[model samples]
Target chain A: MRARLLRFGPDALGKAGVVGSGRLYAAVAAGGFRRYATYRAATLAGVFTNTVFGVILAYTYIALWDERPHLGGYDQSQALTYVWLGQALLTTMCVMGTGFEEELIERIRTGDIAIDLYRPADLQLWWLAQDLGRALFQLLGRGLIPFVLGAWLFDLSLPASPLTWLAFLVAVALGVLVSYSFRFLVALAAFWLMDGAGITQMAWLAGVFCSGMVLPLNVFPGVLGEVVRALPWAALIQAPADVLMGEADLLGTFAFQAGWAVALLGAGRLLQVVATRRVVVQGG
Target chain B: MDSHSHSHSQVDGSFDESHDSFSNNSFNESFIELDGVEKVFDVRKKTGFMRSERREVRAVDSISFRVARGEMVGYIGPNGAGKSTTIKMLTGILTPSGGRLRVAGIDPSRERTRLARRIGVVFGQRTTLWWDLPLIDSYKLMHRMYRIPDARYRENLDRCVELLELADLLDVPVRQLSLGQRMRGDIAAALLHDPEVLYLDEPTIGLDVISKARVREFLRDLNAERGTTVLLTTHDLQDIEQLCSRVMVIDHGRLMYDGPLTGLHEVGDSERTLVVDLERELPPVEVPSARVVRVEGPRQWLAFPASESAAPLVARIAAEYPLVDLSVREPDIEAVIAKMLHSMRDTPKPPPEQAERSGRAAS
Candidate 1:
C-alpha cells in the first residue's frame, strides 16, 4: 500500500489534473475566500463594528496623550498608531478561529471529520491555507479601509522609512502564522473537550489581553511588560505594531515573530497527531 | 441447502438457486476479504452526577467474509447490529481491534490515505458536500481534493449529472436540496474519484419511492458496466431484492445468514401462506404437498415452506377443491429474519471447524 502511494500518489494527482500541491493549496484557499464572500452582510457588519471601535479608540488614546507626555514610552503619534493599527490587526490575529475555527469543531462534533481525514491533504496545512486566504481578504477589506480612515481623519503618522514598512509586512505575515497555529490547536481541542467554545473564548481572551490589542504592553509596569513581550501572543500584535511605530528594531521584531511561527506551527502539528489518534468522531 | 422450503409470490425474481461461494483458499483473488475482523468501542456512561462508568461495545464481532470483484453484496442487520461498524472498518474510518481485512490487497487502517484513492464511501445520514456551497462548487473542490484528471472528472461529472438528473441542482446549495437530492449529490461526490470499491450505508434511507428506484437503477448500472464492487447497507428490503445478489444478515455482531437473498427463507425455516376463498363453509382441503392451517367460514389458509414453488400445490388444489378466489402472500423479509433469529436460539452453536468450512457462522 505504501509502495503504491509512493509510486502513484503524485503521479495520479498530476494525471487527475492536480498538477501540483500548489494547485491544491490554491483551490482550498480560493474556497475559503469564496465562502467568506458568500456572507457579504456579515463581513460588512464586522468592518463597520471595527471602524466604529477604531475611531473611538483613536480619540480616547489622543485624549490620554494630552494628559501626559510619553505615557508607557509612547508619544501621541505612536499611541494613535497603536490604536488604529491594532484595529486593523484585529481580524488578522484571529487566535480563536471565530471565522473558520467553527468548521473544525463542527466536523469533529458531527463525525464529518471522517471525510476530512479521507482527503490526501495534510489537515494542518489545509487549514493554514484557508486562514491565509481569509487573512489576505481581511487585510484588504477590513485592515486597509480602517487604517486609511484613521490616517485621514486623525492625521496619523505613517512609517517614515521604506525599510520599516517592509519589515512591518514581514511581521504581519509571521503574525498570521503564530495566530493560525494557536487557533488550529484551539480547534483540535474539540476532540477532547467535545465543545470548543470554552477553549476558544479563553484563548482569545488571553491572546487579546497579552498581545496588546486593547491596551499597549508598555502600559503594564515592570515584569508584566517583559512577560507579555516574551510570549508568542505579542508577536501577533505588538511585534507588528512596534515595527510600524518604529519603537522596536526591525530585525529583533522579525526574529521573534519568525521564531514563534516555526515553533507554534510545529507544536500544532504534534497536537494534531494526538487528536487524530484519540478521535471519537461524534455522531453517525 | 434444501433443508427448508417456502412459497412467496410477492418476490420479484426467483432466488439464485446456485451459490456463488468464495472459498477460503481462493482469498488471494477476491477484491475484499475479512478474516475474523472485530471492532470494540469504549463507551462511557454517566452513572450519576459527577460519576461515570466505562464499558466496551463490540460493534463488529469476529466477522469473516470475502467479496469477489464486481459482486454487489448486501450487509444488513437491525440497528446497533454492527452493520455500520463493519463498513466503517472497511473504509478505515475506524480501526478494528483484531483480525485481518484487506481491500484491493491493501491493509485499510494502516494506510488509509493511500487506500482512499481506490475506494468511495457514502453515508446517507451525513452530507459530504460543503453544505453552504453550491453543488458544483463542492464537486469542483472534490475534483482538486481527489486530484481527478480534468478529462476524467468532467466525463464522470457529466455522466452522473445526466443519469442522476442533477443538471438543475448544480447551482443550488446542498442544504437547500431535498434528502433524495442530497443523497444523489453525495453519491456523485464519492464516485468522482473513480474508486474501485463503493461502500454505501443506507443510500435509500429517506428517499421517496421514485427516488429509491432511481438510486437502485443507477447502482445496478454502475456495477454492471463499471464493475465497481458495492457493499450496500440498507433497511429497505426492496433495495436488497432489486440490487444485491448476495445478502448477509448479522445480529448482535454475529453473521446469521450469508447467501442469496431467497436463501434467507430456507435459513429461517419460514413459511409462506396461500389464502383461498370457497363458496360456502367447508372442511379442510386434502392435499399431499400442503396442509391447511386455518379454516375461516368461507376462507381457508394453507401454509407451506416459503422456499418451494406454489405451482404444484395450486394445481393439485384446483383439481379437487372448490375455489372461489385465492391469493398467495409473500413472507415478509422482516418475518423471515425474526424466525431465523428465533430458531438460532434453539439450536446449539456449530463447532468452529465446521462453521469456518462453510464460510458462515452458525450464529
Candidate 2:
C-alpha cells in the first residue's frame, strides 16, 4: 500500500477529480477522512461511549452465562469477545448513520446542493468517498480503542492464527462497505422526506436489533439464527464479530459480506440516478 | 449521473480545445442565449390537515434574451420574481421546463458538468467553502475538484489571494470569517479554474460599504481584464450602477423590462421623492402635479412622476410656500421595480418586449 501510494502521486490525484475518474473518488475518500478528523471532541466522545458500552456488555454477558456451560456456540469468554468486537464495529456501521442526516438535509434545505451538483463528480460516488473516510476514521479512532480497552479489562482471548486475524480484518472492511451502502441509501431519503429524522431513527433502530449488536445471531433459537444470518443487516455487525470470535466460517462469512456489499451498492447507485433526475430543490 | 457530455475531452488542457469546433464561432457570438425559456415548479401546499394541493408555479415564464461575450448584465426583480430561477437554469442547477437555453453552444442541463469546466457560480447567500477548514483549504479542495492544472491553479490562487486581500485570512476557518471575507473566498474559489463565464447571485447582499466596493471593483476588473461574461442578480441597485451596463427587470416570472440601465427609467416610468421644508409647520403643500406623500413638522415629502421634469413642481412649490430647504431624490431601483410590478399586475397583457418573444424560436 505504501509503495502504491507513492506510485499514484499528487498530480494523478488532482486529475482524479474529473467526472468519471476513479482517482477523484479516492481523493474524495481521503478528503472525507480529513474532514472527520476535524471533530476532535466528537471522536473522543465516540471512543469513550463505545469503550464504556463494551465493558458493560462484556460484564452482562459474563453474568448471563454463569449458570450455562455454553450459550449457542460462544463460551463465556467468547461471548465477552463478541460484545467487545460488536462495540468496536458500532461506529463503522453508523447505526445512527453518523452526521449524514444533518449534513445532507441541510444542503438540501439550503439549496447549497446546487453547488454540490454543479461539480463534475458523480453525487453518489462523492458521498461514498466521504462515508468511506468516515468509516476509516471511526475504525481507527473509536474501533481500536474499545477493542484494546476490552482486551485489557476483560483479559480477552485473541485469535490464535494469523489467517483468522486476516479474515477478521477482511470481514470488518466488508462490514464497513455494507454499512456505508445502507446508510447512503437512507441518507438519500432526505431528498424525498421533508425531515428525515424519523426515517433515520427507524433505520437505526432496525439496524440495532437486526444486526446482532443488541443480541448475537447464535442467541436466537435454532431456525431464527439462520434467518437472522441470512439478512444483510447481520453482515454489518454480526458477521464481522462472529468471524473475529471464530463462531462463523471465515470463507462463508466473507463471501456473504461481499455479496451484500455489491447488492447494496447497486441499489444505492440506482437510487442516486432516480433522485438526481427529478431534483426538487427546496427554498431556492 | 449522465456521462454523455462529460467524455473526458471537456476536462483536458485548454477549455476551448475541449469544447470542439462548435465553440470557436460561438465563443465570440452570443455566449449566453435563451430562447423562449421557462421554468415551472410543481409546488405542493397544505390546504388542510393530511391533505395538500399541487400547484404549478411558472417561476420563469417564457423569456428570451441573448448576452454577448464580456457583457455584464444585471438581473433584478422583487421577491419570488424568478430572478434566481433564471440563474439556476443557466447554470444547469435547475432544468428549464420549456424553451432552449445555451451557454457557449452547450445545453446547460444536458452538458452540465461539461459546461462546469467553463462556468463559475457564486451564491452570496451561502458559502461553498468547507466550514470547518481554513479558507485556503477550500481552494485546495477546488484545485482538485476542478482539475485545474498545477501552474494555473497556483497562479490563479496567488492572484486571487493578492487581489481579493485574502492573504492573512487564508488560514482562518470559513465559519470564523466575516460575511464579506467569506464571499471573497468563495469568489476566489470559483475563479481558480479560470471559467469563461460567472454567475453571481446577490454577491453584495449583506456586505458593508467598503467590502461591497471591493467586490464590485474586483468584478469590474475581472470582466475588463479576462473578458469573463457576468450575469449578476442583485437587489442593491448600486451593484448594477457600478458594474453593469445593461439590466433585465423580471417580475411575476415575466420580463418587465430588458434594456440599458438608463432605459429602465422610461420602462418603469418611475417616480421621484421631493422632501420640502416650509418656514413653519404646515398642513400640506398644494401642487398641481406633485402630491404630499408624508408630512412632518416643517417638512413634507411630495411624490412626483419621475418622467416629467421636476422643475415645474419645484416652481409651483416655491411660488406657493416659503421654502426653507428642499432636495430631490431619484427613484431607486427597488421603488422602480415595485411600481413596475404593480403596473404589470394591473394589465392582463404581457409587456411590450415579451409580446415579441414568441416570434423568436429555439436554436
Best by TM-score: 2
CA lDDT, every prediction? 0.79, 0.78
Chain B TM-scores across candidates: 0.78, 0.78
| Candidate 2 structure quality by residue, lDDT tens digits, A43-69 | 899899998888888877888888665
* Model 1 chain B lDDT-worst window of ten: B10-19
Q: Judged by DockQ, which candidate is best? A: 2
TM-score to native of every candidate shown: 0.83, 0.85
**Segments of candidate 2 deviating more than 4 angstroms:** A1-23, B1-24, B42-55, B272-292, B298-332, B344-363
Name model 1 segments beyond 4 Å from true: A1-19, A160-163, B1-28, B42-55, B269-339, B348-363
lDDT of 2 at A225: 77
Model 2 chain A: ten consecutive residues of lowest lDDT: A1-10
DockQ of 2: 0.32
The window of 10 residues in a row where model 2 chain B has the poorest summed lDDT is B1-10
